[model samples]
Target: MNPKVSIIIPFYNCPYVDQAIESAINQTYPNIEIIVVDDGSTEFKEKLAPFQENIVYIRKENGGTATALNEGIRSATGEYIAWLSADDYFLPNKVAKQISFMMRENVEASFTNYNYMDETSQPIDHWTRPVFSNNDDVYRAFLNYNAINGCTVIIKKEVFEQAGYFNPNLRYTQDYEMWVRLLIEGYKIYYLDEELTKFRIHKESGTYKHQQAMQQEISIVENEYKPLLKEYIARNLE
Candidate 1:
């Protein structure tokens, strides 16, 4: 049997959440579960009603994406976890292809390339991330900025048990911090050069609305992890 994958979609009041749910439901991979975390959504609650039967819906008081994700993760039963932002959608073969790569490479965690879409779901930029030659380069790149897109990542459930969950206080940069923490715990995020996820950018999206705040949090995470990352590089990397 193919390994089961739990696709967790952290949802707020974003209108495009239905699309995210649909994408997960439509994945080509047969062995997968969709967990939709509703973070106190008020405006677009009706949008989720149609698909509530198709997903594991958990509604909690408004906390943040990190909290929503943690809730979903705790409830997940699959061997692997994949995060799909409420505004983002994955291609049909996203899980199947990424799982194939992870099994073949013997990696516990990995992130793939992703394209961009607008609020209307129209394609924008294609494959927006830089190509890294090796894990060393990937770690070094983290010193400057986050190269891994959280929505494109698929990680082993056991990895979280060892590295711990996302920091609840990090409202925006939790994914960035989590990625760095995994590295600190000696978990490598292998890169799969396939654009399997479509990240949506809209006026209401947190990335668009929280630019300054996100940068501040990113800087804090970078500073907190930089020393450790440098030591890891010196100790492990060539």
Candidate 2:
């Protein structure tokens, strides 16, 4: 039997939420559930109307994305979890291919390369991750930067149980912090070399709107985890 995968989309006031829900609904994978967590959206709640019957919708106060995702994770009943950003979307075969790869490799967590898309969903550019020959290279990459995109990741639910959930205090670097925490706890995040997610780039997108704050948060997370990751790489990978 195929493992059930839960695709969690944390939404705020983004207008592109319908596209994200559509993509999740259209996944080629047979066994899947779509969970849309509404993070106290003041607008664009209408965009979710058409998909209301199709997804397990949860509404919470205006918590950050981390808290929205944590709520979704806690409510998820699937064996595996995949996060989809409200402004981004997945290719039709994303879940199928990633799940097959993880099962074949016996990996508990994995991430993939992704492409860029404008607000109109026009193709922008393809972003390729380095072909790491070993875990050390992957771990070292995290020390300098976040090599994994949260939307591109498919993780076993137990990984969260082991590493804990995304940090709610981290407004911008929650995903980065979670990745580092997973690595420090000895969880290997395998890489799949495929552009299965299209990350939207728009002026209203958080990346474009909060540059200064994001950088500050990134530095704070890196400062705290860099030493631990360095030691982990040396002791285990070297």
Give candidates' CA RMSD values in order. Answer: 1.2, 1.3
- TM-score for every candidate vs. truth? 0.97, 0.97
lDDT of 2 by residue, 105-222 (tens): 9999999888888989998856444566655677889878888889999999988987799999998889999999899998999988888999988999888999999999998998
For model 2, the superposed segments whose C-alpha errors exceed 4 Å read 126-133
Worst 10 residues of 1 by lDDT: 125-134
User: Backbone collision count in every prediction?
Assistant: 0, 0
Candidate 2 colliding pairs: none
The residue-by-residue lDDT of candidate 1 on 53-159, one tens digit each, is 88998989999999999999999999999999988999999999999999999999999888888878888865356788777888988878888999999999988
Q: In model 1, which regions exceed 4 Å deviation?
A: none
Name the lDDT value of residue 95 in candidate 2.
98
Q: What C-alpha lDDT values do all the predictions have?
A: 0.91, 0.92
